[model samples]
Target: MNKTISIIGSGFSALSASCYLAKAGHKVSIYEKNDAVGGRARQLIKDGFTFDIGPSWYWMPDVFEKFFNDFGKSTSDYYQLDKLSPAYKIFFSDDVITIGDHMDQICEEFERIEKGSSKPLRAFIARAQEHYDIAINKVVLKPGISPFELVTKETVTRIDRFFKTISTEVRKKFKNPKLISTLEFPVLFLGAKPSQTPSFYSFMNFADFGLGTWHPKGGMYEIIKAMKTLALSLGV
Candidate 1:
């Protein structure tokens, strides 16, 4: 039987869900308040210059690739990606720390800051990856209808670690405040202070170092166009 689904918003997550559902033979309807699609990924055009109003930064390029690949396509087919140099600039009291645009370079930078830090950084990222798996599989995708859905003996063991303060973890792991701040800033993206954010989000650290930073050549609107194309092709 074909399921009928209505998705609100045309943002990345909404569109992505719509695409997969539609492709799975569902009759999909997307209700977007705005006249155009893309939601937060919408583009802004000005005097011969175009800009992206929100989500100016890009990370986790592979996630984007995976989305496109699911439909027998790749992001390259829709838009060109350029890895940003010095991924971003960080300002601090005494110095400016520039995170590299690549993994090897980031490791080298870490090595310079603290001896034997690079390997620990890699291990930390691995742990974060494990936590990310649990999050995606056990929690995030769940509807959370009951306490039991979110709590269990196994989850109890994991939840404590996730409840710890990000500041305490960062302070304990690395001495470089700049790196710590740079790494921790992503907590804010999820709408929480580092101290308030669950340690589970440390996966963002893995996302930061491992995937590398990227940007579409023209603007993030390129991604929106690609998603719209995919949605239409899927008969959404």
Candidate 2:
């Protein structure tokens, strides 16, 4: 039986849910408190200039591709994505760290920071890639209704990652404070300090150096617009 579903917001998650529900043969509607969708990924226009108010960097392109793929669509169907070459730069009191778009470039940058650092950097990112495989392919797909949802074979073998912190993991491998800060930067996307975020979240490192940084032709809000368009097409 079909049911009427009223979603409370039109953020990315809400818009995505509405599309899924509507596709499942439910009547769905979205209620937004603001004048537009996009939630925190909204746009701000002023003085002949437009700016993305939040989430400018586009990481994990595969995740976005997967989301659109589910609807028989591709991100290119809506907007263009440009990978940033020298992805970004971090300025310290004495030095600047430029994060590159690929592993070889990033490894070279690590060697520049401290001699012999690139070897451990490679090993660390290798482990982070493994975590990424488990996380994006398995863990995140769960409903999250029970703790046991996390007890899968892959996660169980790497259970210590949950108890440890990103800070601990990075500090153990890299001694240079700048390098440590560069490594821990990705954890900030989780909205927590490195010392507080789980080491399992080093998957973000893979998302960073592994997948590389990207930008939608317009802005991050382009994704919101894409989701909104998809939701509307699904009769939301």
Candidate 3:
């Protein structure tokens, strides 16, 4: 039996949900409080220049690719993605450091700052990559409505990581404060300090230097545009 579904916002999450629900034979209607469809990703035009109100960083490009692929569409079909080299810059009170998009150059940067640290950094990222695979391929796909949703065998074995902090994990691998800060920056994307976020979430580091940063040809709004387009095409 088909049921009517009302989603309160038309952001990415809401739009994505509406697509799935509408496709599943539900009558889905998205209600947006704002004039625009995209909540935070909405673009503002001033003085003939475009500016995005929030979220410019495209940290996990693969996640976006996977989302579009699930809808029988590719990210390329909507907007072009450009990978940023020297992905980002961090400014300290004393100096500034550039983070390269690729692992090789990023590891080289680590070697330059703290000699012999690159090898351990590689090992650190390897563990982070493993965590990334587990979290992205398994954990994220599960609905969060039930505790049983997270009680899978893989998460059970990796349970120890949830008790540790990203700060602890980074400090265990690198003695240099700079190196530690660089590793911890990705954790901040969760809006939590390193000491507050779980070590298992260090997969963010892989999402950073490993997967690299990216941007659509136009701006972050392009992704919202694509998602909204997909939802509309699905008869949501």
Candidate maximizing TM-score = 2
lDDT per residue (tens digit) for residues 1-236 in model 1:
99999998999889888998998899999999988888878877789888887788787787788779889999999999998887887777777767887667887877876777777677777877777666655776566687678775546888777678777777778887776786688778678889887777887776676666788988888898999998999899
Give, for candidate 2, the lowest lDDT window spanning 10 residues: 141-150
Q: Arrange candidates by lDDT, highest first: which order?
A: 2, 3, 1
Model 1: ten consecutive residues of lowest lDDT: 132-141
Model 3 lDDT, residue 124, Cα: 87
Candidate 2: tens digits of C-alpha lDDT, residues 1-236: 99998989777889889988999999998888989898888899899999999787898899899989999999999999999999999998899999998989999999998989999999999999999999988889787899888788999888899999999999999999999988998988889899998899999999999999999998899999999999889999
In model 1, where do residues sit more than 4 Å from their true spots?
Answer: 3-5, 111-120, 133-159
Candidate 2 Cα misplacement greater than 4 A, ranges? none
Better of 1 and 2 by TM-score: 2
lDDT of 1 at 50: 80
Residue 220 accuracy (lDDT) in model 2: 91
Residues 88-153, model 3: lDDT tens digits: 988989877788978888988888889999999898889899999998888888887887887778
Better of 1 and 3 by lDDT: 3
State the TM-score for model 3: 0.96
Error of 1 at 50 (Å): 0.6
